[model samples]
Target: MHLFELTCTAYFKNDLDFRRSFETISHFITYAMMRGGLDERHTKSGYKHYVFGGLLPLEADKVYKKGSTYRFILRSPDEEFLTALSTALRQNIDHPDFIVVETHLNRRKSFFITELYSATPVIVTSEGNLFWTMEKNGDIMQLQRQLHDNLEKKYQSFYGEEIKAPQNFIQMIEIKNRVPQNIEIHKEGKKIRFFGNKFRIVPNEDEMSQKLAFTALACGLGEKNSYGGGFCLAGGMR
Candidate 1:
C-alpha cells in the first residue's frame, strides 16, 4: 500500500480553540472533495480512505487566533484521493475564514518496524460513550485488543477484505502526556462533544503485525480517525 501525505500551511480567519481544529479541518476536507467532483454519499461513506493528524506546532492549551500560521498532515493509501484533495485545496478551501497559504504532497515510506507514536487522541467508543487510551482503568492489553479489532474492521470496510487478528501482535502500548479534553464537533447539523485521551502504541514482530502497523499509519488507530483521532508517526526501527 502507498501512503501519501498532504502538508498544508493555513491561517485561521477567526479566533478558534485548538479543540475545534479537528472538526474544522474535517469540514475543509469534505468541501475539497465536493469541489473535486465527489458526491456527498461517497464523501460521507463508511469507508475512510484517509485519516488526518492534528494541527502542528501549537500548544495544546493555547487558543489559535486569526492570522496564526499552522500546519497539519493528512494521510491516505490512495494516490488519486490525495491528488484530488490537493487540487481542491489549491483551487479553493471552503472555509470562509481559514485560508490555505501553501500545500505540498509527499509520498511517505512505511516504517519497517512496528512502533508508533500518537499525534492525536486515540478514541474508542463503548456503549455509546467515548473512551480514551489512558482513562480505561490503565489496561493496556485491553486497549490494544480494541485497536486491533478496529483496524481489522477498517480494512474490511475500505478494502472489502477481512484480515485475521494476529495473536499477540501488540506487545506494548504506552500512554504518555495523558491529557483529558473534550472536542466539540458538528455532525448532521447538530453540535456534539466527545471526550478522549491521546496515547502511543508499540507492537511486536510478525508479518501481520507489520501490516497492522502500516494500516494504522494510513487509516489511523482507534475510532473517529477521520475526525482527527488516533493519528500516529513511526516510533523507530525495531
Candidate 2:
C-alpha cells in the first residue's frame, strides 16, 4: 500500500465550509482523474481503489480562512491510480482554490497490525439499513461477523483471490462511539447521507489477520470508502 499526502495552500476566493469539503474534494478527485484521461477508472463500478482522509486544516473551525495551508491523505494499492492522481494534481488543482504545493508518498507493507482506529467513520449496513450496536442487544459477535465478511468481500474484489477466512480474525473489540453519526455528501443537487460509527479494533495473532488488516488499511473498513468513509489508521506503522 502507499499513501500520498497532498499539501494544500489555501487562497479561498469564497468561504470554504468544512462541512461540505468532503463532497467538494470528492468531485475534485473525479476531475483530476478525468483530466488525466483516466475517466474510465473513475467511472468504474467496483472498488474505487482509493480512500482519502478529510481536508485537514492548519488551524480553523467550520470555515477555512485565506492564506492558510491545509492537507489531506490518500491511500491506495493501485500504483497506476496513484500515479495518475499525482500527475493530475501537479497539472492543476485550483478548484477549491487551493494549490497542491507538495505531495509526499509513504510506502507500507504487511506489518504487524496490532491496533486500528477509525480516522473516518466506518459505514456498515445490512439489508439497506444502518447497523446499530443495539440491533442485536449489543452483540459484539454479530458485529464482528459483519465486519469480517465485509473485509473478505473487499479483499476478493481488490485482489481477485479468495482469502482463507480465519475464524473471526478481528477479535474482541470496543466501539468508541455508541451513537452512530451521519456523514452527508452533496451530489447532483441532491444530498446523500450514510450513518456510520467509529471503532477501535484489535486483530488476532494469525497470518490471515495480518492480511485483512492491511487490506482494511489500504481499502478502508466498510462501505462508501470512495467518499472518505471507513479510513483506518493502523498502529505500529513505520
Candidate 3:
C-alpha cells in the first residue's frame, strides 16, 4: 500500500494544553474534510483512510506556551485525500485560534523492516472496556496480538485485501519504555475518559515483519484511531 505523510506546524495565539490539543486538531481535520467536499457518510465510515499523530511541542514542555509552535503528523494511503486536506488547510490558514504556518508532505516508499513507536497513547479494548497496554497484569503479549489483528483488519477493510504477515508476527514485537496515561475526550458532545499507553515497539528485522510494521503505520495499531487513540510513528520518534 502507498502512504503519504503530512507534517504540519501550527502556531497558536493563546496557550494550549496537551490534553485538549488532540481533540481540537481532530475537529479541525473533520472540518477540513467537509470543506474539501468529502461527504459525512464516507468520512464516518468504518474504514478511515488516514491516521494522525498527536500535536507535540517543537520544544519540550512548551506545549502550553502561547506563540510556541507545535507539530502534528498525518498519514494517508491516498495522495488525492492528502491533497484535498492540504487545500482545506490553506483555505483556513487565517483561523483565529491557531494558524497553519508550515506543511511538509512526503510520499513514503515500502519498507521491508521498520520500528513503530506510539506518537500518542494507543487504546486497546477488552471485554467492552478500554485496555491500556501497561496496566497491572496487562498481558503485553495479548496487547501485541490485538494490535496486529486490528491493523490487519483495518488494512483489509481499507484496501480490500488482507496483509500477509509471518505466523508468529506478534512474537516479533518488543515493547520498550511504556508509559500509561489517563485521558478524557469530548466527542459528539459527550465526555468520555479512558486510559491509554504510549510506548516504543520494535519489529523483527525481516521482510514479512517490515510489511506488518508498515501496515501498522498505515492503519494505526489499536482502537479508536480516528478519534486520536492509536496513532504511531514508523521510527522511534519524529
Order of models, best TM-score first = 2, 1, 3
The residue pairs found clashing in candidate 1 are none
TM-score of each: 0.86, 0.87, 0.84
Clashing pairs in 3: none
Total clashing pairs for each candidate: 0, 0, 0
lDDT of 1 by residue, 1-238 (tens): 5588989888878876786788988888777777778656345867576788877778656777687888888998778778777877767555765877788999977667657887877777654464644555566667777888887777677667777855755777666764665557987889886666666667777777777788888888777777887788886663
lDDT of 2 by residue, 196-229 (tens): 7889898887878778877888888888888888
- Candidate 1 ranges with C-alpha deviation above 4 Å: 40-44, 59-61, 128-139, 177-179, 188-191
Alpha-carbon local distance difference test for all models: 0.75, 0.73, 0.70
Comparing 1 and 3 on TM-score, the stronger one: 1
Between candidates 1 and 2, the one scoring higher on TM-score is: 2
**In model 2, which regions exceed 4 Å deviation?**
1-13, 58-60, 94-97, 131-139
Q: Please give the RMSD to the true structure for each candidate, in Å.
A: 2.6, 2.6, 3.1
